[model samples]
Target: MTLTLYSNYVNSAGERVRIALALKGIDYEYVSVGEISWEVYERINPQRLMPALKIGDQIVPQATAILEYLEETYPKPALLPADPVLRAQARAFAQHVVSEMHAIDVIRVRRFLHNQLGVDQEGIDHWQNHWFANGFAALEELLARRQTAWTFCFGETPGWADLHLTPQVTKGIARFNVDMAPYPLISGIHKACVTLPAFIAATPAEQPDYPGRVIEPKLR
Candidate 1:
């Protein structure tokens, strides 16, 4: 049976898995869910999150889990390195973005939509900069230290770690304005990833309902 990925158009979480699918060159059915009513998604993911993939009859939720599953099941173009230490490092980098830096995008998006919620803009900006600076500082150090063969994040070919890193970097560029100049390796990897057909296929602007056109200034 063809794999079915359940996701909403232009969602960050969904974008994560989409990158993985593209790198693997795996053709799976994309089930696009919308914001209208999530009755179907709610049944699969109680949190009502996008990017819940249905592999055969199994229902998988959370972007991280889905990514790991895909890596394990389809190991042809391996996402993680063969070395255990490097593999752990890859996962660590992936987690650094997912766990530490993810909130910048979330809070920024919230501020953009519901400015009337009384969320202090100054405080939000301060918090966003703090997390982004701290997280990227460490990421820059890590990537610079890695002695690798490929231009991508881990070893060489795009893997689980790169899948997580690039999309978050894309979002950071689009939403947070995180400076990539300080992190040349990260930016280089991201630039390389975007040129690939998979990353191009997963771009937010290519989505079916991408705000009619590109939304500017991220939080305006």
Candidate 2:
């Protein structure tokens, strides 16, 4: 059966799936959809979200679910550890970002570009920093107490939690001007993540509609 990932080129969740695919070294077809592609995605997923995976005859939605599916179906270099507690920890970390973290998307970037969020610059700055500080505070605590050898989110490997985090780190830094110097463990984990081929292969810049010129200046 052919594995087809239907996603937008610059989506965070979509990027997660891409990393999982790369980590498992699985061959799949990439179908890039536009912002308005939600109209079509609604047919596939009632939620109308990206990063939907079509494997054989099954359709999987939700980013974290897709990652778990990938791990269960193709368990080679195992992303999730064998120990149940460790796996739970990893899943918790992933959930923290996907659920607890705020100001994680390109809201600030869009506001900067259009200046149309009805808020002043000071308000925008406060909103952005507020979320990063709150989220990283939780992340820092998790990493500081982690009992692992590889300095990953979970045991000794880059599991689902680590995969969910790396891209958000990029978004926090490039898009929200998040400084990682405060979160040493997160910084270390992100550093380790980039060294892996799967994480490298799933970078947003490598995607097709990556706002090459628009966000390039701000990225630096």
Candidate 3:
């Protein structure tokens, strides 16, 4: 199967899909949308979003959707649990990061706040930090409650939730200047995830179009 991935290195959503593909031991042609024109990207995705997966003749847009397609297509080394309740728990954890936290911090939203809404840099930073803290706090509580023996979010092996959490934590530390000290569980989980080969390989800095750029924390 010829799998082509259109993605931006800095995007958490794209990172999620990339980690999934890596864990599945799948290889594909990676195209960096950051290097392409908007017009070209719009042709690939009407929304012009990063991380669209092209499988054969079919195009899968949206990171969550792409992940689902990958899980369905590659059943071995499953990213989701077989049990229904555990699966729902894992999906809830993934959604907390992807839908709740990541959605608010996307580049488009930050640009809109700065350019269109005329929000100052401080205001934008506050916006990002607030949402990140709220999400991480909830996740910390969730993991604490579950009390799983495994180091990952759900079990011993990393899965859907770990993939989502790792990138968001990476963005939090690398971009938003969010203080991770308060969320020990999240910090610990993130530390554990990064040690894995899949997470390390899927990091933004490891991407081809990373631009050798770095963002120092403004508040933390």
Query: lDDT scores for all predictions?
Result: 0.78, 0.76, 0.86
lDDT of 3: 0.86
- TM-score head-to-head 2 vs 3, winner: 3
lDDT of 3 by residue, 1-220 (tens): 7999999777779999999999999999888886886789899889778789999977889999999999999987999987888899999999998888888887778888888888898898789888998999999888888846468888878999999999999888877678999888888889999999999889888889887885432221
On lDDT, who's better, 2 or 3?
3
Best by TM-score: 3
User: In model 2, which regions exceed 4 Å deviation?
Assistant: 102-121, 211-220
Which portions of model 1 miss their true places by more than 4 Å? 107-118, 214-220
Off by over 4 Å in 3: 214-220
Best by lDDT: 3
Model 2: ten consecutive residues of lowest lDDT: 211-220
lDDT of 1 by residue, 44-103 (tens): 778676778887788888889988888888887888889999999999999998888875
The number of clashing residue pairs in model 3 is: 0
Q: How many residue pairs clash per model?
A: 1, 0, 0
Instruction: Name every residue pair that clashes in candidate 1.
Output: 79-159
lDDT of 2: 0.76
Q: What TM-score should be assigned to candidate 1?
A: 0.86
lDDT (10s digit) by residue, model 2, range 19-125: 98898899998776664476777887776667788888778888888888888889887887788987788888888888777324444453663365466656766
